[model samples]
Target chain A: MLEVSNLSVNYRGIRALDNISLTLSPRELVGLIGPNGAGKSTLIKAILGLVSFQGKVQFRGKPLRRQRQRVAYVPQRSQIDWDYPVTAWNVVMMALTPSIGWLREPDHRVKQAVSAALDRVDMLPLRHRQIGQLSGGQQQRVFLARALAQQADLFLMDEPFTGIDQKTEAIMLEVFADLKRKGKTLLVCSHEWGQALSRYDRLLLINRQLLANDRPQVVMTMENLHRAYGQSLQTTMGGNAMGFSFC
Target chain B: MLSPLLSPLAYEFIRNALIAGILVGILCPVVGTYLIVQRMTLLGNVIAHAVLPGLAIAHFLTIDILWGAFVSGLLSSFATNWIRAQTRIKVDAAMALTLASFFALGVILITRLESRLDLDAFLFGDILSVTVKDVWQTALITGVILLLVKLFYKELLFYTFDPLGAQAMGLPIQVINVGLMAAITLTIILGMKTVGVILVTSLIVGPAITAYLLVKELHQMMALGGLIGALSSVIGLYLSYFLDLPSGPAIALTVFGFFLLGLLLRPVCNLNRENSVGKKLGKKYRSQKSEVSQELEPDA
Candidate 1:
């Protein structure tokens, strides 16, 4: 379980995220949806302590920082340099680095874990290929494999679905369900809403503050959509359909 | 050809210079691979220039020049980091400010103190004038750097590739970063005897970029870059001996020439073409996607 309380973040003396609070239980998948510049990414960064925030975040009744290995994070695709000369296997193996000990290569155990994680993403065949040569979807899968290799109970992914192919999207949803079945808690940031928004167990709709925190059907009401999107609702939702297609 | 090449090896100073050149060649490219991948080649140049003030002050105090160089380099780099962190100024502007100010202070000190030391030797190292002590110092530093890199290769690999991911994993990222900075400073200090501050960055950057274009993995890039660097140093030193050119410039030029050669010959030799695995993956992914998309449409 995770709890965030009174989380406020300021950027250039402007409030990027207002005092916000949320909690998640074990075996739950929460989708974080917000308008552009709604501090979706900032919220995740603050939780991870990668940015300054005036708040407290607790994981499993303890401070998040103290439980680092228990939580795995996959940063936005743009945050990484794809040109770096590393294989998909290399990226996945980074999860086992702390356990691999210093001055040593991956042993048979670590290699097995890396290979298994890569296989889960169907990227094992491309293990030794340079990561940059992979398509954008494959690149996303590689990062997912890395998080899988971490074997963490909590997963925080920033925009894991953006710019990915349909197949990758299906694989990601499947992995989320698989992780949920394994009693892992996941918080994924996404900007998509057509039929895809129904997949999450809960949706936390935010715009600088917590607007809604409930089941996807209950929280995605037109009123909440208006509050979250403001004047940009028509632009964001595309032609006044007024809600997610699945809804 | 043999006599022209063999003649330089007879003198002790020339032989010492040769040894120093080879060490610098091997070390710079290995370290430079990190700099290139991290997009911090400019940072290396900044630290190289910043070492000058330290060099001048150390000369004035009649102490070890390497100590001053290392200290000043670290100070400037750390100062750059501090400024970037504390203020809104970006890393490039901060580096520019520090690079200019530190280098200016060094020039002023060299002029004002009247130390009787040749600034040219520091700016453009007179490698041909190297003593055995310089060679020994280089060897020690090279050994230490290689050892540290070997010990921390995985950590460095992860850190260099993805800092945020590594930090999330509770890796001591800041400590790793500082350790890397110290290693780079040590490398630049050792290189001062061969390429000097003005041309030292080229020595660091040239071979790494050369190797990057030819390899698909970081370790391979480092190994190939080391070989290229070593060869360039020997070849450049030989050219200096035969052509009566400046050793630093000759080596820098030779290293850059190797990079250019790698660039030109890549397509000819298929040196940088995607490997078999990559090609196979590309074909399979395209075919699978097409099949899937066609199934979804089922067009007339």
Candidate 2:
């Protein structure tokens, strides 16, 4: 379980995330949705302590930062350098880095875990290929393998579906379900809507602040969407009623 | 056939230079690979130039130039970070500004404080002038860098490839980052003896980039780049000996030549292979494309 209270992030005197609070229980998959610059990524970064922020984040009643090893994060694909000359196997092995003894190579068990994780994502056959040589979906899968290999209790993913093939999306959803079945917690940040929106058990609609945190159907209401998207929805309805209706 | 090579080995200066060059050959590319992967090759050049001020100050003060070089190199990097943090200037501009200011200060100090410091030796090194102590220093730095790299390869790999993920995993990324910068700086200082400040970046970047074009993995790139670097040093030394050219320039040019050759020849060589890696990659891609299309169908 994870809890945050009074979380605020400022960038050069501008409030990026303003006094947000939320909690996530185990065996739940929560989707974080917002318009561009809505602080979804910033909120995650604040929670992970990747960015400086004023907040209290706790995991299972302990300071989250102190219990970080129980957490696994998959950053936005755009945040990584695809040209980096590493194999899928190597990327997955990163999950076991904290456990490996200092100055020693990965042992048999480490290799086995990496192999099994890679196999779980159906990427074991391409394990030796350079990461850059893989497709976008394969690259995402490689990182999924990395998260699976972490064997963490909490998973925080930033835009795991962006620019990925449908296969990767299906696989990601399947993995999320599997993790939830195992009593793991997942917080997935996504800009997607429509059929994909129905998959999450709950949604946190936010724009610089928490607008709604409830079931997907409850949070996807027009009022919450208007609050998050702002005047754009009004403009759409005034200019193109059909378009607004489709939305 | 081997007499010319053996004859050079007889001279103490040549032996020392060769030892220094061989060590640089091994070290530069290893560090250079990190630079290339991080897209910080320009930072290496900046640190190289930035060391100039420190070198001049050390000469004026009659202190060890390596200490001065290390301090100035660290300062330049720190200054870049400071400027980026405090101003709207981007990293490239920050590095440019720091590089120019440091080099100008170094030049001013050298000209005004001491005219007989042999600035050329600092700018463009004289490999034949390397002493036994220089060899020992190079060895020590090399040992430390390689040992540290071996011990922290996983953390380094994770951080460089995915910094946010690494930080999220609770790795001390700030410490790792500072450590990486220090290692790169130490590498630049050690390389200063053979290639000097001016051409040392070539010694670092050329072989690594060349290896990058040929290899698909980081360790392979480092290994191949190391081999190319050492080979270039030996070949450059020989070219210098036989052609009566400046040894540092010769070595730098030779490494550049290697990079150019790899760039031009990789595709041509790939064209003739039985199971060309590129073709194999294409085959795998075609299969992935079909899988993607099949899954994309609405009914699926």
Candidate 3:
């Protein structure tokens, strides 16, 4: 459902990603694994078209803007400031903003969509609670509910399991399994290989470029694992002739 | 509306001053709400101080100080944006650069204007000499600014709360940011009359921040900030009347006092909530997790 080719990103004359190419098939559950500053987020942001990048990112064989309606992004929890008084409903309702779907006062369909999404993630009980009042796991699930409410065909989730309890992790895996069964595609970036490799059908190991993109059983070989997390590799965000892509 | 608060001499001045204070109060919170959320309260201080030279230069040139304040305030706001966009220097550093350089120039200009013109009245607002024309100016400028905020609140909230989401949604994030900067500039400019340039930012920031720490919701914060800001202005003015004190400083201090009281009140509530929620969730999560972890550990 998503294809990226020769992507490069430069921040202040330093290359964060260098000629990275990856792809996900329809309804595929793909895991992206990397160390800190491995261009995992850069790839996600570049795909979202939030920043400038080079190369190509196509979803459903169209540019990002044309196919943006079909894509959903669940950012890492640390990136948000939860102190701002917002409820789960507010967060989930963003799935339908500024469209024919925009509801000044939520209608039946909007409420149904939000509630169903929350129910899918096992968080219907927390629907009325302020997002700040939720636990870490539930907060991540809340964003997933929002993504699900968008009814998007593709989900790009970055580090959804960080600081979450085992129940949340189990819930996340169940959602992924369900998404796969329902013909929806997902690209999840994670650091926990033992759990992720066991769950996802494929894994894409990224460090500036496509280190390996294949079945997790094959790509996550001992050699690849050592190279990915071995002996403290120098990971500079802006480095050599590696970046400068726009898609 | 007739009130016992003013004599004929006192009425005209108080009327003008009250209009100015109320206008400043209303406009300050409109922008101050955003600033408080963005942690840009110090940025307001920088802009307030930076406009002094603008007012001083106008005084020296025998022109209107309001235009001078507007031009300088906008310049500072522009500079704040430029500095943030250009370099890795933190926002505070950029603010310090603008504040020191601009205010020092204002100090020199005011000294020069002092010899050639009556500048002390503008320095510390001689609000008691306010004319009907001044009241009209306050009403017109503040009215336009507040109208802009009312019209653009949704767009502003989108960017202020979710910049990444707004950009993804294809909103002009830069334009909205610039619009907010403009609102903040107009607020600081008009606020200078009631509180003077030196303490204008304190008036802008004090009550808004107090509400920020005390309130959890965005709409509540805005409402509380406006109510507190207007209250402080009226009460401070009254205290200055009875105590025979400097009105601007007295009001600023009162706002600061309210902020301190609100700050002290916060921890008590937070600590109580934290204790109860932690105890409740801790037991439930632990029992649930142990049961699940056992189920997962079977293959080993």
Candidate 4:
């Protein structure tokens, strides 16, 4: 569903990501795992055309720009301004704006789509809550809801499991599985590889470049893990309202 | 036993000042919120100061001030864009350069106009000198801006909150940005006669910031922003009347006063048990920030 070639991103003199090549087929569930500063997000941003990069990215056999409508991106919950005065519903509504009018009110169809999307994520309960009031997992769910509203064929999520409750994570996995069943492809970036291995069908270990890409059992060997995240796994606890535990 | 004691003549000026301040107040904060969020205060300052030369030239020609302000504001707007496009110079630096050069040019023009023009009227603002023509101009610009804001509300919201998302949506993000900037440029020029260049930003920042504290929704915040703007305007005009001070400063300080109220009231509101949503949001924000850097640099 997506192809990236020679992708390199340099922030000033520091190279965040070196030349990297990877591809995903239709209906594929791909997992990206790496250490901090491993260019996991840099790859995502480069593919989304949000960053300046030397490489090229193609989606659905079309150029990235042309296929943007078919792709839905769920950035890390931390990247969003939760304080933005928008309801869960408003955020969902926003994802559909590309399909509808900017200023025009949503038609019944759009509303129905948002409703179904929210329902898929089990977030229809908190549809009216101020987004800022949501927990990290809930915030991620909202983005999932938004993507669902996008009704896109391809899903790109960054750190979807970070800070989320185990229940929420399972629910998200189910949603992704359901999406895959519907012939929708997903590429999820995650720090927790143990959990991702079970959730994703294929795994790609990345650290500045593609270290490995294959079945989880073959690609997630200790050698590849050391090459990607190193032997001493780094743990950073985010102080979020959810009080997520790392150890 | 109180009496409603306002003479028609005094009342007219009071109404005019109040209404004028109210309009500027809403527009400033509504626009200022985006500016502050995006760290574009310097841009507003630049545009505000940059238009002085235009106003000065207008004075020289002895035509309407808004006309001169508009021309100069547009020139400075283009200048800002040109500098942004050409150099590695960041936005603040470009604003500093263009605003400084243009404002310096304005200073020279003001110096020239001093020989043939009214000083206090432009610098401190002569509220009493406000004619029906000035009112008409203010009203016209207010209508233009509010209309523009209404038309572009969705796109502006998208751009302000998420520039990347807006770009992905195939929206003419650049054109929208330029359009918003143009509206701000017009707002500053129109407000110059009432608030003067030095103090116009407060009107913009105060109402919105104040409302930001009071509400959690965008629509509510904007409405409250306008309400605060209007409230401050009336209060400022009334204070100006009794104190016999300049209208713009009075109105500007009034907006500041409202900001103080917001500061004092925020904690009180947050402390309210019934406002659990506010308290919850406050706690959540604290928690999220705490998790920002888990894999820290050991040396650092």
Candidate 5:
């Protein structure tokens, strides 16, 4: 479980996140959605303590900062250098570094975990392939496998759906469902629109501040959309008769 | 052929120079692999040139120049990061400014002091004149750096690959970064005497990149780069002895030569084509959203 209270972040004196607060329970899949530059990513970074923030974030009744090892973060694909000369296996093996300790090689047990993680994401066949050679979907799967290998309680993923293929999406949804079943919590940042937004158990909509925190049907109402998207929604709607199509 | 090459070991200075050169060759590429991956090659050059002021100050204070150079090298990298963080200037511009200013100060101090330090030799290196002490020092530094790298290999790999992820995992990212900087600075110091500051980046980046073109994994790249670096030094020293050329330039040129060879052999190695394919796939995925758009379409 995670609890955030009165969280605020300022970048260059401009409020990126303001007086935000939310809580997540185990076995929950939460989608964080907003327009571009809506500080969706900032909220995640703030919770992870990657950025300076004014707030208290607690994980299972303790400060979140002290419980970092229980969290696994999968950053956006753009943040990584695909040109980096590492195999898919190498990327997954990184999750075991802390447990294996420094100066020690990954033993049979560690390798089995990495292999099993890769296999879970359907990437075991390409484990020896350099990451750069993998497709966008494959790349995302490799990272997903890495997150799985971390065996963490909380998952914070940034844009895991972006640029991925349909198969990857299905695989991810299955994995998310499985993770939820296993009582793990996930906070995923997404820019997806339409019916795809319905996949989450709950939605947290924001534009520099918490706009709505409820079921998708409640959060995706016209009034809430107008408030968060401002004039952009009108332009995006483009005089559609049926209002904005769910797709 | 073997005799011609083996004959150079008859002299002690040549032996010392070869040992020192091989050590520097092995060390620079290993550390430089990290720089290349991080796209911080310019930082290596900045640190290399920044040591001049330290060298001058150490000379003036009658202290060991290596200590001064090491401190100065680390300071320049820190200063670069500090400037980038505190100001609007980007990292490249900050590095260029730091490199030019520190180098200029070193030149000025060296001139002002009119010290007995051979400016030309210091700038260009005099490997043939390396003493036993130099060889011993190089070996010691190489051993220590390699040991540290071995001990922290997994942490460094994770940090370099995904810094934010590693940080979130509570890996002490800053300490890891500082440790890497220290290793790089010490590597530059090791090469300063063999390749000199001016050509040190070649020793640092050349073989690593050469191996990068051929290898698929980080450890493989380091191992192959180390082999390439050692070979380059040995061959470069032989060329210097046989043809009477400057050792630093000879070694630097040899590194370039090996890089060219790697480039030519990349096709045969079957790595370059895969990279290009990956690029093509990336571009196609970016330009066309048809697959995603179709899947997202609501039921008719």
Candidate 6:
């Protein structure tokens, strides 16, 4: 379980994330959704302590920062340098570095974990290929494998579905289902819409503040969308598709 | 055949220079691999140039110049980070600003003090003039750096490849970053004697990039780059000895020469693999096209 209370992030003099509070339970998949610059990523960063914030985030009754080893984060695809000279195996092996201890080689068990993670994502065959040589879907799968290899209780992913192929999407959905079955907690930041939103047990609609946090059907209301997206939605969507009919 | 090379090793100065150069060759590229991967080669140049002020201050304060250089180099990097954090100026622009100001300050201090420090020697290192003590210092630094690198390779790799993920995993990313900066500064300081500040970036970036063209792993790049660096230094020393060229420039040019060779040879070496993969894909596409045509023939 994870709890975030009174979390606020400021960039320069501007408030990027207004006072926000939320909690996530085990075996739940929560989707974080909002328009661009809606502090979705910032909120995640604040929770992960990647950015400074004025709030408290606790996991399993301890400060989240102190319990970082029990958390796994999959950053946005754009955040990584694809040209980095690392293979999928190397990328996944990074998850076990802390456990392997300093100056010690990865034992048989460590390598097994890495290979099993890659195998779970159907990427074991391409484990030795350079990350840059992999397709976008393959790259995302590699990162997913890396997160899985971490064997963390809480999973935080940023835009895991963006620019990925359908096969990757299906694989991710299956993996998420499996993780939930295992009682793991996942908070995914997404830009998805329509029926796709129903896949989440709950959706946190945000735009600098927590607009709504409830079942996907309850949170996908027109009023909630309008409150979070504001007039930009009308401008971007030409005001004709204002109804939340798709969901 | 080997007499010409063996003859140079007989001179004490030549032997010391070779020892120092070889150590520098091994050290720069190992540290430089981090720079190349992070796309922070310019930062290496900035730190190298930033050492000038430290050297001048060290002379004025009558302390070891290496300490002064190391501190100043680290300060420059910190200053760059501070500027980037406080303002909207990008990292590259901040580095440029920091590099220019530090170099200017160093020049002013050197001129105002009328110090005995030779600016020419600092700008263009006189490798042939190195003493036994310098060789010993280089060896110690090399040993310490290699040991640290071996111990922390995984952490460094993780941090370099994915800082946020490493931080999220409780790796103390800030400490890792500062450690890397310290290592880089120490390497730049070591290189300052053999390659000088102006040409040191070549030693730091050149061999690593050369190896990058040939290898697909970070450790491989460092290993191959170390080999290339050592080879370049030895060859450059020989060229300088036989051709009567400046030692620093000769070495720098040798690094460039090796980089060009790597670039040229990379394509030829990878061609076979690429061609094989390309042929397989070509066959698959052709088969798919034929199958589609066969299916369409009945419809037509």
Give each candidate's interface RMSD in Å. Answer: 5.5, 5.1, 7.0, 7.6, 7.3, 7.8
Q: lDDT for each of the candidates? A: 0.88, 0.86, 0.74, 0.75, 0.89, 0.89
Model 1 clashing residue pairs (backbone) = none
Per-candidate interface DockQ score: 0.52, 0.50, 0.21, 0.20, 0.40, 0.45
Candidate 3 — which residues are off by over 4 angstroms?
A66-69, A100-112, A122-124, A233-247, B1-10, B53-68, B105-123, B264-300
Residue lDDT tens for model 2, B1-300:
988679988899999999999999999999888888988788898899898888888878889988998999988988987898777788899989889999998899888887467778878988899999989999899988988887888888888888888888888988998898899999998887788889999989999999888777788888999999999999999999989999999999999899889989788643553245435545666767665343223231
Order candidates by TM-score, high to low.
Answer: 1, 6, 5, 2, 3, 4
Q: What are the per-residue Cα lDDT tens digits for candidate 2 across A1-247?
A: 7999999998878899999999999999999998889999999999999999998999999999998889988989889998898988899999988878556789899999999999888777677767776788888999999999989999999999987877777888888999999999999999776656778888999999999999887887788888898877664345433332322
lDDT of 3: 0.74
Rank by DockQ, descending? Answer: 1, 2, 6, 5, 3, 4
Can you give the lDDT of residue B92 in candidate 5? Answer: 92
lDDT of each residue in A165-196, candidate 1, tens digit only:
88888888899999999999999999878657
Clashes of each: 0, 0, 7, 6, 1, 0
Judge candidate 4 against the unseen true structure and give its global Cα lDDT, from 0 to 1.
Answer: 0.75
Every model's TM-score: 0.94, 0.92, 0.83, 0.82, 0.93, 0.94
Best by lDDT: 6
True contacts recovered per prediction: 0.63, 0.67, 0.16, 0.29, 0.70, 0.67
TM-score of chain B of each: 0.90, 0.89, 0.80, 0.82, 0.89, 0.90
Residue-level lDDT tens digits of model 5 in A1-247: 8999999999878899999999999999999998889999899999999999998999999999997878989998888999999999999998878889867889999999999999898776567678887788889999999999989999999999999887889999999999999999999999777678879999999999999999887888899988999999876556452533442
Sorted by lDDT, highest first, which candidate order results?
6, 5, 1, 2, 4, 3
Question: Quick one: how many clashes does candidate 4 have?
Answer: 6
Q: Candidate 6's residue-wise lDDT over A70-168, tens digit each?
A: 888999999999999898899999999888987898999999999999989977756666788777888999999999998999999999999888778
Q: Give the runs in model 2 whose Cα sits over 4 Å from its true position.
A: A234-247, B268-300
lDDT of 1 at A127: 77
Error of 2 at B150 (Å): 1.6
Task: In candidate 3, list every pair of residues with a backbone clash.
Answer: A8-A245, A14-A238, A15-A239, A53-A245, A53-A246, A54-A245, A54-A246
Give the lowest summed-lDDT range of ten residues in model 6 chain B: B291-300
